[model samples]
Target: MQQFIVTPEVRFLHVVTEPSLRLAVLEHISAGEQHSDNHAPFFVLETPTWDGEGEWSGRAEELRADYEELRAVLAQDVRGVSLPAIWKAPSGARELTRFCLELSEMLRRLSVSPFDGAVLVLAPVEVREPERWVSELKTLLALEELRKARLMVVEVDGSHSEALAVALAQEALRVDARPDEGQLREDMATMLAGMAAAPAGVTGAQVVGAAGPRGVSPPAKKTQARLSGEQRESLARELKMAPALFDPSFQQALRLKVFAAAHAMREGKSTEAIKGQREARDLCLDAGLNREAVILELVLGGYVLQAKQAPLALEVFCDARKRAEAHELAELAVQAQLSAASTLLMLQRFESAALAYAEAGKLGLVASQPLLAIEGYRMCGQVLARAGNVAEATAAWRKALEVTRSATADERTASSAPEVARQLAALCRKHGLKAQAESLEAQAVALEEPPLRQTQGA
Candidate 1:
């Protein structure tokens, strides 16, 4: 394999059948990059500006421009280096003129600071025109300068049928990497994500006539913080998450084991606690105690979290949520749902987390749990805001405030109402919603007023 310093054969493909493989494939690519000095020998583009389950905004022509962000990323090698931007493609060019010019210009940039090829992963939310995008990419890859550049399109959850169709169109080169939970925890905990590389070997340029725009000065380098599972899952614990919404059908012996597990947790014997709860959970299921089993599973999730195994905790919470719903354990469903969603947020899968939060909020509403409903909606706003959906975020926060206000007579609900109103008010002020902000602020004060005094004023 080391016959040459670099492998020249480049390819484009998808690994959509298993979402877990997305990161596995990324790891494989990173392993290859370990041999190169370039900081960003690869880039992943999954987020989209347009709104579709995939890419569909009716402006297909603007698709190429949509990825202009890539140019700055790849153009990193030319930054502050002596290179002629002499091969600039005409801004007005169209069709073959555009493609040819772009290819030619990219080749020129490659000469002074030649990148040893790149892996470009286009994990779009969805790809509406797989063939069209592929065809466009082929035109770019046709040039030898880009010989090592490859495209890998992926959808992490395998939720899209287009992924399968896209794979069939090509002779499938299967990526066989599988998920290892413990390994994923360790890997993510210490992972150092790569980005744009600074150029080397270029000194100063000899101007033929004049200098071109000082070729894109590199952006300040920032490092991504390592994600650790060891962080406390304090968010869920504080929520006073309920056990399964069911009458306890515990055998005397099984209840003893459950108590022992709780005792173990208090003693900091997380592993023992987790094992005990799992046993209790299984026993409950075997004894036709589906709701009781779910309760035990929920207990087990906390044990898993305490042991600093958040990935496994998330899985347990998700599994419990599904089962809780099936058993119509509304209260427990909201608990498990929010836990699973928050874990996703910690994992930095923003879109999935946002959707999960929305589901949890809606479920909380259905369950008539005002505090849980407010929390779910509030966090959904937070996740949406983090994902750059300000409008949606505002709406979510608004919904949370509404829920809080409607249930203010309840002690727990009233206690949290002012804070919820202030949160929405802050968001409103940030986005210049002055009237809304003022209204929310007034409501926040009114919420804090004693019920008798408030009624007299009204």
Candidate 2:
């Protein structure tokens, strides 16, 4: 068997099967797809007993005829081929063209599908013309329909299957590099299953533009990573495997431990807190604990803000704010906004902070956190006033006072209104307008209607 990497978007798997051709199919196909996404050509001309469960049995010559029949079906340039079922086929030029054309269409679709996908093709190992497969595939894919796509090709031989197995391990690295947690996990699972059946050794695995650097396995553990027997067993249980099957757990635990080590980096422990937070977030996603993740993100956002990294801090808090809005955590969203605004303030981006604070105030009011609402309102007013928009500032402060008053009943003390009024009064006085300050003070007292009096009779 031989492996070839043609383009980033395309992969070709070539193998030689004499008496039986099932090895190539079993080497690649798994439950990840209803069928393999490899749109490339697979040929098993001479094979027997390829289908164990089905009645699809044929001699080598019969299988070759079947392969040609499939080639005829997909020989069209537009409509694509489904992953071909293993069968016998004799070779022909026209049949190969038809097969390549259809297979080409299938490859084109995989590139743009919503889910990341792959293609697998298996054929009888020996062929009259191996170049025919490659040329036909390239021509079919070069059509306007698939001009910009990527492809990868792998060929296998009995002696090289072992090397192929090691090369297949690179799939883990590809998945691990993905930033999206859900996608990463899905890729990891699929790759693992693929690796489970891939041949153990091959001459070389050519991964086109992808498959990353050749021979790079998942990152090696920096130090001796130890796990208690019980912990190992627990992890195996989570993965739904027996204790004896611990390789996957080792990788998962390493990833988690790397994140955990980040937490106590300063103390020289193995883990990092940021990594832990990220893993926790990923865990939340896996468990469908969205609310928990959102809340945790809010806390993490605050921590970033406190660390005084203004830009990075804003990104975190803004994400939290968006999540809060989605979950209807209006109060929490307001808090996130306030935190973001403060970070902006520290950066001397006063106008931006003022706008953020205004948004926080609005959300706080709607969330019924009147005191916080008022405080935000006051801050925005002050910001506007300092920016020299006296009228807008005054309006903002008045709106803040109204919100505070409306939060209370006549019998309830005017919470925060007095302090706000005094602040407004002083601002008004500073503008050399005693009458406006007096009016504000009067409104504060008058809010209680001065207790209905019997003096009307007098």
Best by lDDT: 1
Model 2 score (lDDT): 0.50
Backbone clashes, each candidate? 2, 60
lDDT of 2 by residue, 160-233 (tens): 22233234343211111113546745554444434333332211221111233344444435683544679868
Best by TM-score: 1
Off by over 4 Å in 1: 1-251, 404-408, 411-415, 449-458
> What is the RMSD, in Å, between candidate 1 and the native fold over all Cα?
22.7
What local lDDT does model 2 show for residue 56? 19
Q: What is the TM-score of each candidate against the true structure?
A: 0.42, 0.37
